[model samples]
Target: MYSLLQRLRSLRHGFWYGVSRRIRWSRGAFEEAPARELCNVDPEPAERIAALRDRYQVQFELGMSAATSRNNYEYLDLLDRGWSSLGIGRPSGGVLCDIGCASFWYAATLQAFFQPDRLLGVEVEGHRLFRDGRARIDYAAGYLWRLPNAEFVVADYTRCLLPADLITCWFAFLTPAAILAWRLPLSLLAPERLFPRIRHNLRPVGLFFMVNHGPAEAALAEGLCAAAGLRRAGRWSSPAALSRYRMLPSVLSWWRAG
Candidate 1:
């Protein structure tokens, strides 16, 4: 949806473009932002599930080692906005947090698309330029903690949301093969506990996306969701560009249950 040049320009100077007090806006955003908040994650069914990440590592995207992400609406948004970055977490309402949100490409995209609403992205590293004038996207750069106006928080797959409309995990899971390493080079030592956390974090029929890891990865992820009691809404596939680190070609999974 965006040419390379335009995307680059947007990235380099999106803050600049937004600097003018005369920033433009989409009429629908005011309506959509609030409505979307109603969809926050909940319903996976667990009263006391311990956190799964089990490790206090740096958030991936904002810096260098970010988790996987989509190349469709996300990529297209950045493409259109003229920026190149790690599109970390999902867009949720009501204290949203993209657990494991890396660079927060999605927040940037929302700023580009919606152009008005405030989006606070919590990461291990902060990245907000207030002078840019684009409603200063919040960057709670540090280990995840419950914060005000911070609807999201990055965590391990087994982590659950306090309460949110959406939870985006863009292929941020163990690989089929690497699933055996079980050390720092990997992610965590306890693999068995993670699935339960993923299941616990879901908001009943909340939405989560996975672009490509392979049929096996999809099936395993689906099974984990089912065990967590989340029903499958459907799966979708479409042509989109992926990050250099992205290995998937199409987003082949989706879910919703209430």
Candidate 2:
């Protein structure tokens, strides 16, 4: 009788285990969407894009968010044009660092455009709740594996210190709280909090590129620029031609260290 009862308990536990296995409760992982659907790519030499994709595996999605103008091929085009306008790659060879690089999409883009002497990316994984921490670790590692010229450090930007001739922040913001509460102001995010570290990390005459999600954040970025004692180089908003992108604020501002 005791043996029979023990077997019954074992069977019961196995059945529930099977049932639980069938039901997924975890938020799981970040889903990949087709890259073409997310962005408009101007006609470029096949070699260029092919090389980019091959190196970074940056198809399906551009960055952390696909919302509005946050993620797309047009963003890269805009960066290219903005860099050209700012004369960023002038006289050649310098280190380029991307803060909150996420998957290193922008880092790869900068490398291709500027051909920087060294490319470094700083990111803090599991910063968002949407994706699992393990997934983010894997993604960051994959980016480093594919881009031989690029190096990524998994550390929070607010504290991590890495030197660079150029540093860029693209849609990097504080995660909003519950719907009932307000979104954290941009002033409190890394751009402002890490200003001192950024100043220290940048080489003399180094540049910082900040792209805010909208006009409101642009105002905050301006304040950050002032707090850091950085001189404004130029500012550009989203172009009229990008109808979808225009919905977002899309302010691109450059600042130079003294």
Candidate 3:
């Protein structure tokens, strides 16, 4: 019943949050943003899973959301915001780091979509998610082998140092703070330290983009942004705009180097 209670709490949160943020929703926001492309990969899960196995020589599973992502325009829509929000016009071969990049899907997908100079996906699990840590790393490395420019590392961001021209964090709060509180609360409470690291590593005038799903989450993110001394670039609070990008009560905030 602990699980049931959790689900109930989640449902309640979604209901209240949706009602409170209803004013921001609009279909027009989606219409106004740049167009998005649908997923081009085969619809069959077996086919896709097989492809990963053959390429990486490991048995890996993709979350239902990410597996079906390409079939719809949602993923591309999110990427559209990532690109437009950061003001990345063309590929200048800049470095991009995705924090808490689990399963390496965002890192891999965005790498293919944006073709940046280099892409770094940092996760705490490393390769241990699979049979052993090596398999996971091998899977990530092998998957991006052709890309050559993209690399994956298993490490905690708060304890480690990482630099990038563009840094992104998406839906990280989905993971319960309790699970992360002991290991690295800074990532949850105050990621100000990461701000300086990004500033130090990012190219001139680099960008940091953060998305949080609800008011509560946005509050935490804002605190981190302030602690990091990040200058707000822009925000998308409109309901339609947030929904179009699959963000919840979402605050799409970006920061530029001061």
Give all TM-scores, in the order shown: 0.44, 0.64, 0.58
Instruction: Give per-residue CA lDDT, model 1, range 151-171, as digits (tens).
Output: 333333344444334444555
lDDT-wise, the better of 1 and 2 is 2
Candidate 2 pairs with clashing backbones: 214-249
The candidate, 2 or 3, that scores higher on lDDT is 2
Model 3 steric clash total: 8
Q: Pick the candidate with the highest lDDT.
A: 2
Of the pair 1 and 2, which is ahead by TM-score?
Answer: 2
For every candidate in turn, the CA RMSD to the true structure comes to 18.1, 12.9, 13.8
User: Best candidate, TM-score-wise?
Assistant: 2
Name the lDDT of candidate 1. Answer: 0.37
Q: Mind sharing the TM-score for model 2? A: 0.64
Evaluate all candidate structures by whole-model CA lDDT and list the values in order.
0.37, 0.58, 0.54
**Tens digit of lDDT per residue, candidate 2, span 129-233?**
223433443455544554677777667677866778888777666322211122222223445566667777878878888787678868876776778777788
